[model samples]
Target: MDKIISNKEKSYLAVTLSGDNDKEVIKQMASALEEEGYVKDTFADAIVKRESIYPTGLPVGEINVAIPHTDPEHVNNAAVCLGILDKPVTFNVMGMEGETTEVSLLFMLSIKHKEDQMGMLQKLISLCQDQNTLKEILAKDQDKINEVMTALVEK
Candidate 1:
């Protein structure tokens, strides 16, 4: 398993996602990571199950997003799959049961080390809090997305 954090070419940035539901979207992202050797074959199922119990959907200032991930046992390497959905999909809001959000961005994290997971989530949450940066990410293309992700992780 290769570390994709520092390698721009290996960045798993999906320019467009067509999944109509959260499960479908997560499966698509997990499948991509699995193909790149970042995660095990069981990653998709694990993440889907985890998501149901502890949702990752965050309602940022303007744009809602999700950070879906599973245990380190299901991951072979540390990587993130940034999925930009073509249309918003419904996802249960984190820490808010019975409430849902329409998320257009999904950040599927596959972190091999448990210690690194919170650090990565902090960076992503920081990025989410910054409306300007989030807007820039949404406006940018695949290459630019890679740069943004690389810079964020490196920080």
Candidate 2:
């Protein structure tokens, strides 16, 4: 994991059953942010490119999690956006998960320091054990997903 941003500080949480590839999913999240004026069109394309060759999917030993991201030069502001998938989205893994896994969440990170998020990333990985919390967020509709995301900030 490069570095994971605070789930609380993360503003956008989109519950999407996106396309198969990591780059495709990155495009989905990045396009939404771009439409929201958080990033440029070329920036989104750059993000997809960064994620294409250098995979950001983290293997949990059993399954995988997609951490699609790019250089801060692609983003207009410092923020984090998430895309949760109930149906698995196939993305490449960095570890020995062999091939790939059905990713449940897309923790699309937009950060300043590409690697300084080590501590926060560690914290996020630790929090992954909270299955109930994860389930609640994953099971939400679009409106409820926003609420759940906003609640993280309140806490």
Best by TM-score: 1
Best by lDDT: 1
Every model's TM-score: 0.88, 0.71
Scanning candidate 1 in windows of ten residues, the lowest lDDT window is 1-10
Q: What tens-digit string does per-residue lDDT give for candidate 2 at 1-155? A: 11122233454545364565666667777776676566667777887777667666765633346777677777775555667654667776655444666777766666555565664456456545556656665665455555544543331
Quote the positional error of residue 145 for candidate 2 in Å. Answer: 5.1
Regions of model 1 farther than 4 Å from truth: 1-12
The TM-score of predicted model 2 comes to 0.71
Error of 1 at 4 (Å): 15
List runs of model 2 lying over 4 Å from the truth: 1-10, 61-64, 96-98, 141-155
| Candidate 1: C-alpha lDDT | 0.80
Error (Å) of candidate 2 at residue 94 is 2.3
